[model samples]
Target: MRESTTLLRSPSNLASSQRLLFNSKLILPSPVPFKPKHMPCKVFCSQTSESSSTQTLKLISTLRAIPDWADGIKERGMKKKKSLYNHEKWLQHRSSLRHVRHLLSSLSSRVILSLIPPVIFFTSVAAVVAAYNSAISMNWLPEFFPLLRASSLPYQLTAPALALLLVFRTEASFARFEEGRKAWMKVVSGAEEFARQVMANVDGSSNVALKKALLQYIMAFPVALKCHVIYGSDIRNDLKDLLKQDDLSIILSSKHHPRCMIEFISQSIRLLLLEESKRTALESKISCFHEGIGICEQLMGIPIPLSYTRLTSRFLVLWHLTLPIILWDDCNWIVVPATFISAASLFCIEEVGVLIEEPFPMLALDELCNLVHDSIQEAIAMEHLIHDQLLTKRKNHSNEHLTNGRPTS
Candidate 1:
């Protein structure tokens, strides 16, 4: 798998990099340094032996050959791909670190400040309690109320109720995550089926080039979607391979790349369905793509509401505070253990729920963008193989026509 790199450079720098075009490919270095006044660039250039001059000519001619309609498509596709690639890259890059050091560092000063008062108060209370206990033992008053004690009836009931609520909420959040995964699977399956139908039923002889381009689009759309949802943009060369030059031009000119790509995919599907014989079947498959997009959008747009989150957090905090008080009366020594267990349980539930609520975002545990990229590449490769076969068949047909003295139009 090719690793993505982010480049931070000025427009002049970007122009310079584009001109370099070494070996008909760009070599992206790992941990590419970000210069002032530029964004980081993803590194995953091709490795070819062609000289920079040849690469420039090739790029120019390729751009010129792209249809006008394809003008902005490549840029849009690339933006979508890069966003997903970056997110997945970040997730993968951060997986080894058990803790987020940067986040911890930011909190260090505040944590120290918060600890002082609690430390002083607790120490003073302990000293006074010890003195009072000694006096009472020496027959000063009567007896000392045990500082640590177990819970009574109210706490027993409250603990079980809170536990059940936490468990239910966590399970519900997990169910949403599972649904999001299933939806993506449906997208992949539907896209594959639609591509197969087009390849099998469409007339290969009429506009073979256009048909091949459409097939590439079919392969690229889902990959673009995966990138869009996960990383917020596309940063892969795979997009450049699939998008037409005209479309690429338009995407570069536009601001909303993902939405544009979605529009392009919808338009392509519409055009494919305009064919006489396969119209109905193609329409059905297009509907599947639409449905899949809707499902993913639902997952992305509707998260566990903030109201519920606030309520849960408030309840947990209040529950914890009262917990020590309740237990201090009966289970003095055991209060420590009980408090620790309760806090751990509440924190775990909150953490798990938060992770599942946004299934599209790449996490340390996410199925990285590389998975989607690989699947898309597989689809494109299959399309390429089919195109090659079709070309071979055409060549053989032409040969047979010439041998039989027929005109080869």
Candidate 2:
């Protein structure tokens, strides 16, 4: 009774959910179809009809038609670079000066742009202080400028503290980045494994529609999750071709699309014409999806402690603000360029820290989602070919036995 009611829910993501990480189902079994001649597969077996062939071809084309997330999706953040995983290629990228376009369009530019205001402010302070010292010495003007500098003793004493703050801030953000990567890896692997199980276990003509729909949900899960973790993403556009209109509406209308997709998977497993033990085994794979959602939420909902971030920022400003005074005794006017170099270099580290803190933007979620979709489709496309190859081997084995007048046991 409860399982039947799941379909009637207006949106699978209930209007209210108290299970917050942040700030932020069963179906009836269908009747088993009777066995028929030429059952090539115990699971997903069909009569090899023209309609089935056409359906298979249609599925392949539909998968191919879905656009890749790696191309032209820069608004969501992150561009795909093949060399990120290739050490040799990355070295070449680093050594080559020809990638002027890369320098202009990369996340590097965004970080530099963000640093502009602070870098200018601190460098100007250095310039003004240097000029004031000159003006007072030459009697050209009175000391009207603000006293922006302090003794260098504080910078010397707190230098270790600043180092520690920067180190901790960057380390914490990178850890979150690594955590997100691993969580999605689980999701990808889970999707692949679950699809393989469905393709190999769920059998017959009666459940053909169910089998196809189940694969569609498996493919849709990662895309839903990709949208869920990142801001400004619409799941409908991504899933429109992959899922049926009704199912897509139900999932997209839900408050949490990724969780809604998981519910769809659970209900599909329940509806499978499988024994209790088999269904339970299949249902267990949903944990991977859950784990991914939880980890992504944890990273998105909770950031590195605010105290750490604020402390680092304030320390940098104060240190650079007073930096010229400390060097005024020796470096004098040279403090202008020195202050610029220090501010630009140090602030860049913090900017990069902030960039990767959210994790999702830095991640290639689009490509990862597309990989899951492509893998499931690729496996299914090869199914009949694998079966036919096995059939040919079996035929040859039987003929050899007949010729030798023995089974060769």
Candidate 1's error at 243, in angstroms?
A: 2.8
For model 2, how does the per-residue alpha-carbon lDDT over 304-395 read when each residue is reduced to its tens digit? 88988898898898889889998887787999999999999898899778878988878777878888888898999899788889999999
lDDT (tens digit, per residue) of candidate 1 on 178-285: 887777777677767776776677666664765676666666666566655664444355467667788777755666554566566556655653465576777677
TM-score of each: 0.54, 0.73
User: How many backbone clashes does every candidate have?
Assistant: 45, 1
Error of 2 at 328 (Å): 1.1
Query: Could you tell me the TM-score of candidate 1?
Result: 0.54
